[model samples]
Target: MTTQSAGEPGEQGGPLGMQIDHVPSEPGGSGTPGPPGPWQPNLVSTPAQKKAAAQAIEDHIEPDTSKAGDHADDETGKAVTAFAPKDGDGWVTSTSLKSAHKTWGDQVKNLMNRLASEKAALRSTGLLFQTTDFGIGTGLRQTSPLDGY
Candidate 1:
């Protein structure tokens, strides 16, 4: 089933359905100010939230996605190997398939490595921000008190 936000006038929602709106007159230039009001931030992530996201990726998403890719890679290898010519006569198709399989396996490995890197970055984010905050607070505390004029 397709899903869309209300009042979007036939706009759909999903990765492929993403739409860009309100292009500025000049590229990358501030054109017009938005309607003045109390603006809420679109993104707000706490240290705990970052940590939890990292945990979820490591514990669930990474494993599930990698498992599917790995299974596909293995199955493809087995199938291609089975179809390969024994006498090495008509080996064109088999060779092509083997090459494609290797390419796909490399892609999957790269994706898994990227996910692992992302997970590591997420795990360290909380500590990095905490240290930054502490340093800022300490610097502020070191300031001399103002005297009455």
Candidate 2:
């Protein structure tokens, strides 16, 4: 379930229920204190997100949560991105951290296992070695030759 916590998947294949609470703001007060820095819009995960997930796993075999994604000064400023959503542009999910880690580990392991089964000729030329990047955003394998190897 989506509500997994590392070792076991929950009954629902996801967290049992998802709820959101917006942080309260003081009356007549802005969220920022200084000028905004370089504007880097949040990189949204497209419907075809399997690729991104694969990349994140390869680049970061173990997510530290402290440095998951891009961290530019946001529009509202105030170091807001540390809580940006893991999937798209929002907030860090309250889902089980344990489950997320296990899931990521399995993905990387499976890819490596598959790579091990490849024919030795191609494997020697640069098959498995070519795909590994020790970085989450770069490890994802490209589906099209048009994309970089």
Candidate 3:
């Protein structure tokens, strides 16, 4: 009683249905050959490109702090600041309002820092698309809950 492998002809219920003529042991195979060399994309950023991207991000965030200050000056903004309690000598002291003000200020600072860090990291390593080019190609169609109308 002898057994035949699937690669052999006349083996009906074997792993491989058809017989494999030959198998190459080389890395690629005995064919046209692999790529001439390693392939690279043309979109990779250079040092200058990375620097420019970082600079652009910095420039964009530069006005954000001032904007935050302006927003804090509004009535609602002042209300947040005024939430802080004043001491007997009229010096603003630790209180819920002071904490709220600190929290808001920290949030704005964190946002700026995060944006700058993300920009730097992304610039160092090129991204599929720049931050600004995200929504360029899109249809103008708008949908809402009242779609039937």
Candidate 4:
């Protein structure tokens, strides 16, 4: 339930820009483990529909290849990992971009609402939810043929 403050919406005082770790638990390990109790955020039940919806949502994330796709770079001999800021050792966002907090919240909420709707659609498929799988393998990158990665 941690969220940005109603007022000031963007700053260190508020929790707006903070990235919360969302660990999607298994679909149904509770009780008898036969049927899914409910459609949890991270838990994609056995039916491929639920998993497919989750996959689509994940693919929409426009990953910063320099920060993400590092695995690919390692094999290709490219250093994609960001180096620590010479100014300090720990994480620190540029002060000029402080207002980004509010924007980030808006983006996350919009994506979440879309994902929720997709999950609901899967639930209506009339199949028992047996297992959950949060698959984020199929990544989508908008790369131009001119800009070789």
Candidate No. with top TM-score: 1
Question: What root-mean-square deviation over C-alphas does model 4 reach?
Answer: 25.6
- lDDT by candidate, in order shown: 0.76, 0.43, 0.61, 0.48
Total residue pair clashes for candidate 4: 2
Q: What is the lDDT of residue 117 in candidate 4?
A: 72
In candidate 2 the C-alpha lDDT for residue 2 amounts to 24
lDDT of 4 by residue, 73-95 (tens): 35323221233245566234433
* Sliding window of 10 residues with minimal summed lDDT for model 4: 129-138
**Best model per lDDT:** 1
Higher-scoring candidate on TM-score, 2 or 3 = 3
| Shift of residue 71 alpha carbon in model 3, Å | 4.3
* Candidate 4 residue pairs in clash (backbone atoms < 3 Å): 44-132, 46-131
Give per-model TM-scores: 0.61, 0.20, 0.34, 0.24
Against the true structure, candidate 2 reaches a TM-score of 0.20
Report the C-alpha lDDT of model 2 over 43-141, residue by residue, as the tens digit: 643433534455554456434322332121122233334444656765543234434555655665665555334323332433334445334446465
Off by over 4 Å in 2: 1-95, 119-149
Question: What lDDT tens digits, residue by residue, belong to model 3 across residues 1-33?
Answer: 344555655545445443356554444555445
Question: lDDT of candidate 4 vs native?
Answer: 0.48
